[model samples]
Target chain A: MGRSPMNREDTTKNRILAAAGPIFAQRGFQQATVREICDAADVNLASINYYFGDKQQLYIDSVILAREQRAQQFPFPSWSDDTLPEVKLRKFVGMLLKRVVVMQTIPWQVQLLMREILNPTEACRQLVEDYFRPIFDRLLRIVDELAEQPLTDLRRTQIGFSIIGQCLHYRFSAGVISLMVQEDQREECFDWDELTHHITEFSLAAIRNLGSHVAVKSSPRTSETH
Target chain B: MGRSPMNREDTTKNRILAAAGPIFAQRGFQQATVREICDAADVNLASINYYFGDKQQLYIDSVILAREQRAQQFPFPSWSDDTLPEVKLRKFVGMLLKRVVVMQTIPWQVQLLMREILNPTEACRQLVEDYFRPIFDRLLRIVDELAEQPLTDLRRTQIGFSIIGQCLHYRFSAGVISLMVQEDQREECFDWDELTHHITEFSLAAIRNLGSHVAVKSSPRTSETH
Candidate 1:
């Protein structure tokens, strides 16, 4: 009885979000209008106010929804305690590559997030706190297990960034890389699974050797001859 | 006496380029105007036509000049046969870091090149051929010296990109990283020297151990438990 109206309300909100996501993704916040979103959703203009309160809220929700949809589609597989850090790392890196980079089509959310990276707003700050912080924490946990012993937060963050940097490079430099790679090797170069393997193995080798055997000098910059 | 005309022409052209580079960097190619470039150069607007012939030629010359200046500044040391691969690798990576990432103020040339990245044109293609291809080849030579056996082009490229990816991540994600790093460790986090050291060591460890001891499997993707 009471739940019926609530479910209807939920449906309308979701419909508005689905319509608004791509519009907001394509056009920035100021440019994306409530009328367009309502028209796209096939609802009247009042529906935008009724469902989302305002256009700004609609934009924020769309960005959040974009992240949530991907998180749902490619959720991380649950790993037990006995799982090797190496295996955990491989899975984590592979999932990030898949979610962010390896997709056949660039998700509207990615474009939306790219917009945020350029012009960070309140939503971007919230995203950092809610979404990215958790992922960063997850990476730190995995890196902790790989350390020879308990490592400093800085070292852990560096190792995590190293792993992340490799993954992100593929996404950012895809254009330049395409131009640089020979035509014959382009197929292998773009294959997500092959790339994941390479990045994983490369990072694993670095992590395993880093703390145990790194030959630090008095000043690393001074050692450079060039 | 013939050289006098050439010298005068060179000085005026250099002046125009010096002014135009920053304006193009600040305002992208489409928006940047020849009049503004000339005004900043303290030369009449006609000087743009007289020195570079056209706006397009001026933009191209500015892009090329950006690359040339950096090349001259951080040119790789001529290593002797006796220099260890470790030392060579350190210097190569360090020089790259110095050139791209480790700077007090990002040279406008960097911003100008960044514009090329977003909207590539003739200048970008020339950049890849004349500037980047040679750097890539140099990286291959360093990696070759470190390898146990002669590596394939793909392998060498992957290795080189891994190093480059680590370096570039800092520049592209500077804002996100600033937000992410904790307050107490902020200084070290942003320190270019410290960053260069970490990246160089992490990469060297990976390169040294990668082919020699990377335990290969029949199917790497299938081996992940998660």
Candidate 2:
């Protein structure tokens, strides 16, 4: 009854999500307007209600769409393959950084996700658990295997943050980063290749240095004193 | 005349900023309303209009207030002391992460700053540059010296991201992180000490490795050759 190869409901829903991607990225979920999304998609305001049931659902769908796109573009290879753990770790870091930065495939979606992390909405909570959390867990496992010791959940989570943070910082704060580096010669600007390399190497070293005792102790005292 | 301070303008401005601090941390800048701020401070709404001129300015003042507090905490002596680079770096990472995670000293200003970074109002542009950028640049230099290389700006920046990402990821995604570690037998789920150790080691290794590059350049037009 809908268009060929797609249900009418699914097609309309996808269109709404696609339209929301950039707006949410550009202006956070708090600021994005439903009317603007409808206008951008060239669909009736009622289409959102019919397909997804609410504005919040549309946003969740948009986040899912972006996550799928990122996963596809940077497909997670089986670490079961013969590559060394370090090499596998490096390649994964490279692929992630490339997809996250050079591609800019889902810039706004990523920003929206960050917005949720910084200031959670009910919608962000749902998507983060179902979608991003699993991927992060798996990635942490991979890094832990390459690491000197098995990590505590807290350590695993911290490593996950480090890898992602290094890769996404420039893209997430492109304007601020550009300004910060403006005084450097034009030839010395940030490059994706070099950026990925540094992140891979730095993160690897940091993980390898984590002691075996990390899983047992929980102290408010900082590592800075060392 | 203002209540008690020598300078009435400074008193009023500081009061407005002081009131704005917890409100912004709790509600975020966009969600924080002027009336709520006025009510909390026990000051007239007109005073805000009179002194800072607008809601955005009050927000900036609050951010600056928090930033100044943090800057005063991370003194240059922390880095420039006779301690070895690795020791200094670990200490710095631990100190910074503790400050970010503890929630009392620095508050949640970092999250607010990051949100503004993602979605900047004109007011935040200069504030970010003035407060955060220089600190990051200093971080880059510290990372560079630790690595013992004349790192390219790209390399330094990448390492900078790694350190921060590793450090801040736990607090930023506390919801997911808490869940990830909740199953552990440890009575206190979030282990700050262990997290700091893992991140410091991971970051140090990554930075150390950046100085050495071993990847062979492949021919641009080769069909396939190892």
TM, chain A, every candidate: 0.82, 0.74
| Alpha-carbon lDDT of model 2 | 0.64
lDDT tens per residue, model 1, B79-161: 88998887777777777777767265678877787667544678887788787778878878888888776776667777888
lDDT top scorer = 1
Model 1, residue B188: C-alpha shift (Å): 1.6
Clashes of each: 0, 12
lDDT of 2 by residue, B8-115 (tens): 354656677778888887777778888898888878888888988888788777777766666667554354566677776777676666666644343666656655
Q: TM-score for all predictions?
A: 0.81, 0.79
Computed on C-alpha atoms, the DockQ of candidate 1 is: 0.38
CA lDDT, candidate 2, residue B75 = 56
Chain B TM-score against the true chain B, each candidate: 0.85, 0.76
Write down the C-alpha DockQ for each prediction.
0.38, 0.41
lDDT of 2 by residue, A122-164 (tens): 6665666776677676677678677676665655665676777
A1-226 per-residue lDDT for model 1 (tens digits): 6344553464667788888888887666767788888888888889888767888888888888887777888787568899988888889988888877735566777768756654467788787887777888898899889877777777788888888888877776666777778888877786777777888888988887886786333464555644
* All candidates: interface RMSD: 2.6, 4.4
